[model samples]
Every structure is written in structure tokens, then in C-alpha cells.
Target: MDNEKVRLQLYMARCGVASRRKCEEIISQGRVSVNGSVVIQPGTKVDDDDRVTMDGRLIKPTRKNIYIALHKPSKFLCSNEDPDGRSLAIDLISPVIKQRLFNVGRLDYLTSGLIFFTNDGDFAKKMTHPSSHVEKEYVVTTKKEIPEELMENFKKGIYVGGEFFKMKSYKLNGTNSVNIVLEEGKNRELRKVFQSQNINVKKVHRIRIGNVKLTGINSGHFRHLSEREIKSLLRDSSSKNGKYNNKGNRHNIK
Candidate 1:
């Protein structure tokens, strides 16, 4: 594939070594070598035949793309490395998988549940794109009771730091918890929403994306996403039905 030579950082990301941003750091650190020469430039290009290594370890993309759903437990970093020696979610993955995998989106160290890992860069990019509008559902337990106005405010929308935040829908759970659905959440949007309203969030656990739910998998374990599930993500994200229908499996994504 010399004709399709790509940048070193992107190649490393495709190999699932890390995100393209992290790969740049790895390259700059002189840890990556291509064809027996250390590569320090992110723009350096490599072909399929080129031998590449990171930290003296071979790094290559696998033949088949894999998509995994992890029931991430709280307190695990959603990264390949943690500076403070904290537990990383990658540590829980088995090595039997053929390729390096990177997370689709991040879950906070204290937030846990259905996070995705994949080797297909295009898939990750497409799924995380704002236009995709991939919905995510979370079960959150707040430290204090929610205000009556907060629910209506969420339905209308809230702005923090000039970014608009709104919930697709929410249902109160007992006295201190609520199940909220989001349409393509921004970084820490949920936290910001609750914190802005002076709510103390005790825990946040993602339970659903598209039609996939965190029911069968145990905490700290992972499983493969079904073909239907994957198609559902691509399909549902484009639907016009702008509301959640947890009662039926035949609902469309909007």
C-alpha cells in the first residue's frame, strides 16, 4: 500500500496504539521507529510494508476491525496511560484481541458503564461526530433532590460557557436519581449541567446508546456489539423521531 501511504500519527491511531494526538507525543518522544529509523515527526508517512515499533514493541493494525462495548467500572481512567498511576480501563482488556483499540468516547474516572472501544478509526470518528447525534442514556444518582424547575429548564435547554446543553428526556427515579438521555453529549456536559444547577451528583452510569443497553454484561467486563446494534447506531442517529421510546425496540433514533 505504498500508494496509500499515510501520516505516522494516523497510522499509529489506526493500529489502536492511541488517539492521533497521543501518537504525536509518542512520535516526538522518539519511541516510534519506521524501517529501522526513529520517527519524530507526526507528518512522516509510512506504507503497509514499513516496519513500525513503539517503545521497541511492534505496532500494527489487525486484519479485522473490532467493536467492543465495555461495562466500565468507576475509578478507571479511559486512557492508555495515566500519569498518576491510577487504574486505566485498558488494563482490564484481554490481549487476545488482534489489534490495538481506542475508546470511542471518554467516561470519567468516576463514571462507569457502556463505553465503546474500536480499531476502525473511521467508525470512531463517524460515531463521535456531532452530526451523527448518537444518543446516550445515563442513570445518575444525585446527592440532593432535584429542583422542580430543573426538569423544565432541561427540556428548554441550558447554556454554559456559551455552549448549549439540553436533555432529550429525563425520568425521575425514586427521590434522588434520574435517567437522562442525551443527544451527542459534549465533554462533561452532564456534570456541567448538574453542577451549574448546584446539584451534587453522586454517581453517573451510562446505560444505553442507540438500542444497546447495559443489561447482559457484568461491571468491568466487555462484550462484542451485535451487527444489528452497530447498524442501529448508524440508522437511529439519522431518524427524525425526536424522542425516546424505551418501551419498544422498534423505535427510531432522532
Candidate 2:
């Protein structure tokens, strides 16, 4: 093993298993094992040759990273497995994807539209990092007409779950519909934003991520992103290799 080591949870998080926090929970439950022995410590260090498994499934270092964009439909989980047997978005993909892939972020059970899946944990981490400033565009439909002050409040920022979560931009698409851009992907953020105002969010469909958008892809379908799209996203996320530079992740894909 090298002198520098990565935490087990962090490695799993990077492998697209789950978030560091969630991976810790998975560890505590004794679902993780290394070197043919059951291990439950999140801080355990692993080497390049170590064989790590979760629930008896080998999780290898992502050899050839798979990046995909799924036009998720409602009533599906962003997870690889569902104890309740509900549909998983990954199941919608071909079993041929063999690699232990996972959703980059989440879309919950109801919200739908553009969601991402990847085997590259570093890319997932970089994309979700708060510093990435990735822009998430959504189309929301409310149960009722929105108030006039909603835009102003969103523009000025609103206090949600302790921090100020603001909308980078929003457009009124209809009396009960809006297209909003967000820099952060907080849990059920759109719902929370409107819920705090006593407004009911009926539907939320993510339209775009970075420069990639859902075009001509039908619901419940997915497609591998082009190498160009991947580079653009990485570039837009940050100057990973100094190819592109931007002030904030708040900028949209042009």
C-alpha cells in the first residue's frame, strides 16, 4: 500500500457507490467487505489491488468509465437496487452495462427528466461538488398560479435548510409553469422552495445539465454522452485541465 491512502467511504463514493455519508452508513451496516473479510469501518484504507465488495458483488476500479444521460420517467428510483422492488433507473438500462454504475446525483421517485449515471467516481464527485458550480435547468409545474413576489424572492435568494438557496434564473412559461435554473442540487430543492411558500409543486423535469440537454430522447430512455459532451461538462464544471475557465457554475451551456 502507498503511504497516501484514501478512506474506504471516500473511495466508494468516488466509485459511484454512494455519497461519502451514505457510504459510511452502508459500512456501519456491515455491507462492505475487503480481501474476503467483512469490513464495517468507513475510514479503512484500501490499496490498488484490494478486492472490495458490497453485498457480495465485486466493485472494481472503473476501468472504462461509462457516462450516460437518461430521460428518466416518473416512478423510478435513481438507485441500483430497490428493496421494495420498485423499478430502478439502472434496470431500465441494459444489463450489458456490467459495471457497477450509479446515478451521479438523484431525482427522487416523482421528479423526472434529465438525470445522469456514471462509473467514473471522480467525475461524479467533481460534478456534484459545490465548487463545480454546475447549472441544473428544470421545468416545474405548480398546482396553482405563482405569486408575483416569487420571482423577486427567488432572485434575492431564500433561506432553505439553513443556507440561502437561490435561483440563478427563471422564466415564466405559463400561468402555472416555469423554467428555472439552479446552481445547486439540493434534495428535492424545487419542491422545498415552493413548499416553503405554501405553493404546491406538481411536477419537476430536469431539462439540461451543463451544455447537454434532453432533445428527441423519449421518456424512459438513455443514451451514452459523446466524448465532446463529456469534455464540455468537465470544462464547464471547472478548468479541470485548463481547457476552459469560468467564474461560477451558475453559467448555462451555450
Candidate 1, residues 172-252: lDDT per residue as tens digits? 988788899987787887888889888989999999977889999999899999888888876765452333333344332
Q: How accurate locally is residue 39 in candidate 1, as Cα lDDT from 0 to 100?
A: 80
Task: State in Å the error of residue 1, model 1.
Answer: 5.5
Give Cα-based local distance difference scores for all models: 0.80, 0.80
Residue 203 local lDDT, model 2: 91
> RMSD in Å for candidate 1, one decimal?
6.1
The estimated TM-scores of all candidates read 0.79, 0.81
lDDT for model 1, on a 0 to 1 scale? Answer: 0.80
Query: Runs in model 1 with CA error above 4 Å?
Result: 1-3, 7-9, 19-33, 36-45, 95-98, 161-163, 235-254
Q: After superposition, how far is residue 211 of candidate 2 from its true place, in Å?
A: 1.1
Clashing pairs in 2: 14-121, 133-249
